[model samples]
Target: MGAQEDAGFSTRQVHVGASTATASPRATPIYLTAGFTFSDLDESAAHFATGSGFGYSRTGNPTVHAVEERIASLEGGDQAILVSSGQAAVTVALLGLAGAGDHLVVSEHIYEGTRGLLLDNLARLGIETTFVDTSDLDAWRDAITPRTKALFAETLSNARNDVLDVAAVSAIGAERGIPLVVDSTFTTPYLLRPLEHGAAVVVHSASKFLAGQGAVLGGVIIDDGRFDAAASGHLFPHLAHSDRLGGPSYAEKYGRRARGQYLRESVAPRFGPSPSPLNAFLIGQGVETLSLRMERQSANALAVARWLEARPEVERVDYVGLPSHPHHALGRRYLTRGSGSVFTVTLRGGLDAARHVVQSVRLITHMTHLGDVRSLILHPQSTSHSGRTVAERELAGVFPGTVRLSIGIEDVDDLVADLDQALDSVASVATGGRRTDAGTRGSEREVVVL
Candidate 1:
């Protein structure tokens, strides 16, 4: 009670931010008011001047702070900033490090929204980005230039399940004094901690596995809290020098937490991606059972991947947990826990078969989102990656028959049975409703499309 203390992940998740103990309510109370009242003008001036108190919800909130603290503790990061959504997280995190004319080296395969952000919106603002294959170290090295401010990638890529070599890429960035930023939404802290693997910064789409229930949307940016301006001053001069009116540079004021502080005070507030206190509370509640949910989901996903691999109508399965995956070794190296619940499976019969599978699934919801408690399936070629060029889609593994699956914590057998029925529907369409023994080598029946 006398001094602040550290705690374990689960403990911190439940109690860290709410530890201030205002009303002695066990659950983190949601401060729904837009602004906090100050005792007098002097207190208000101090709050604004030093950014100590939560004067406004846009800048900070107690509920949101608890979520941020919990995430930072689990992620092994110095500090965390909560935003409205994953898109906002990426936008603020990148802009906090880069500006107009700055360049970013990014993995070719990432969430489509992120691709759009870099190539469409940020591009319009004069920021340039170069995409490199996730596994190509040489390509990553070649893509960097004088203007390159950061290296960005997903810890576990969307749909295709390509596991990023965080340590390898972070080493490359460290050599060049560039910060390596990774989107770790797929592999939440329960599965992986990018910051521990040398990544300078970590971002997450809390709407996914972090929220666990798909009831709220939030995002977080966690810095390793060790970026030194003196070491990387030339590359990140913006953080090292005075950019504010007459205030000291962020690095001078916050030291190792300069980037995080800048994002908290300047970027997130000014950009206005403030998350609702209620959403923060919901997400925080989800964080409580994150590890348990992830364990079950990962197991169910691996089972589904195995079942799909054996199906005759299936062309390929893109899951890092599978031994056949190109990145299985890398995944094993980096992802010690299960390889996440989201992956893609390509059917042999092309777009028609994909549509049939999406339409026929009874238990699996046909939705664009991922990481829900309920199983979800989607045809990414026609949805998430539709705007991308054919070549781009191919590179990202969004084939005509590719259907992305986000496995849930439901019974593995039930999930597989649902897929089997969907596959049978596809087979019936492919084979004129004539049942074949194709997919039914053992227990699964043959599915065909006419």
Candidate 2:
């Protein structure tokens, strides 16, 4: 099915890839078998050579395929590949295009885990990377070297909530003949499809908003199928020469599906990070309500950001949806629907005060994970970015007082009230001010019209 058809987003989510020939189940079934039996020797040889059908669960499965198809349809990509985790998806996507001696350009404000993977793991492999400010197109241009194979950035940076100029970056990549790979974990396909904005490849950490309920861990890479491998052969030698797969080059075999095919057949099998059929099924179920959850979550997050911005204890709030945010106009231009649910705020009293607010919250859980039905809050300087050096953390905009909040589907009034109490408690302790009167405890909760 094509996206141009009469089918809407909600309709596609519900009906796409939910049926299979082997089973009559209305839902996508978990094909738990390790290997598929071939009818004969000729069929086995054909399947092995062309990958026309599933041969091993480590490589492919019906349930996983269903999830891939659904995600590809949602993102408006030519094809998609599912992996075990978000990091795995990122690693595979990078490795599929680049190798030893090649360089990549990445946003400094990306997820800390991803930054670590690129800086540490890929560096160890002799794949060099240059980190730059994603908002600046000139920084991206200056950082691109002859060895640069791809340009990578997040649609909405984790914790920092920085908005990437997708079209500008895509234009730079186009001029340089490099594919632009965007991690759209924060925004999800419901709010913004990166491919539609000229990104050659789009990735997602399905563990976040895509799964919605945070019940499963999975990742996906979608191929926009627009980049020209022939013109950029030196940067992407894997697509140019495929001696490992019996001399059939990736571009020659898969054409526009080259990236997805390489990720599925070569990278995923060797890396052994393929998603389980059950996990894929859970992700498929999560996609059905992605639009609804994102809408409510975005609205709740905007309300909470506004509330936090007005609090005296909050030094600053870093939600792109907020007018006071540095990238608010850019977010409005690129992110038409909403910025995102995950954002950061700094406390007036630094780490101690930030910790107090985190501890005082009643409804929002003080956990590391984001995009759940239950709200979550965390301090990145102590949690996700703890491993980084002081200079590195500062470069990534992770201040000691910074607190990340992943707003959920809770009632806005209740969420605001919870935050108000937490901020008040933090203020009382931070400033050495004692809670004295009845108004101090429940003043904000009471309705007072001027």
lDDT of 1 at 46: 97
After best superposition, candidate 2 residue 176: deviation in angstroms?
Answer: 2.2
Q: lDDT (CA) for every model shown? A: 0.87, 0.83
Per-residue accuracy of model 1 over 87-160 as CA lDDT, tens digit each: 99999999998988899999988988999999899999999999999999999999999899999999877767
Which residue pairs in candidate 2 collide? Answer: none
- Which candidate comes out best when scored by lDDT? 1
What's the lDDT for candidate 2? 0.83
TM-score per candidate, in order?
A: 0.90, 0.89
Candidate 2 error regions (>4 Å): 1-23, 242-246, 430-450
RMSD of 2: 10.3
Q: Write the per-residue lDDT of candidate 2 for residues 1-450, one digit (tens) a residue.
A: 656357988898786775555648788878877888888998889988888888899988999999999999999998899999998889989998888888999998888788888888999999999989877889999999899989999998866688888988988988878989999999999889989988988989998888888888999999887647766766677777776748878888777677677777888899999788888989889999999999999999998899888887777788999988888998998888887799988776766576687888899898779889789988787788777666666566566667889999999999999988887776556433422221121111212111
User: Once model 1 is optimally superposed onto the true structure by TM-score, how far is the C-alpha of residue 216 displaced, in angstroms?
Assistant: 1.2
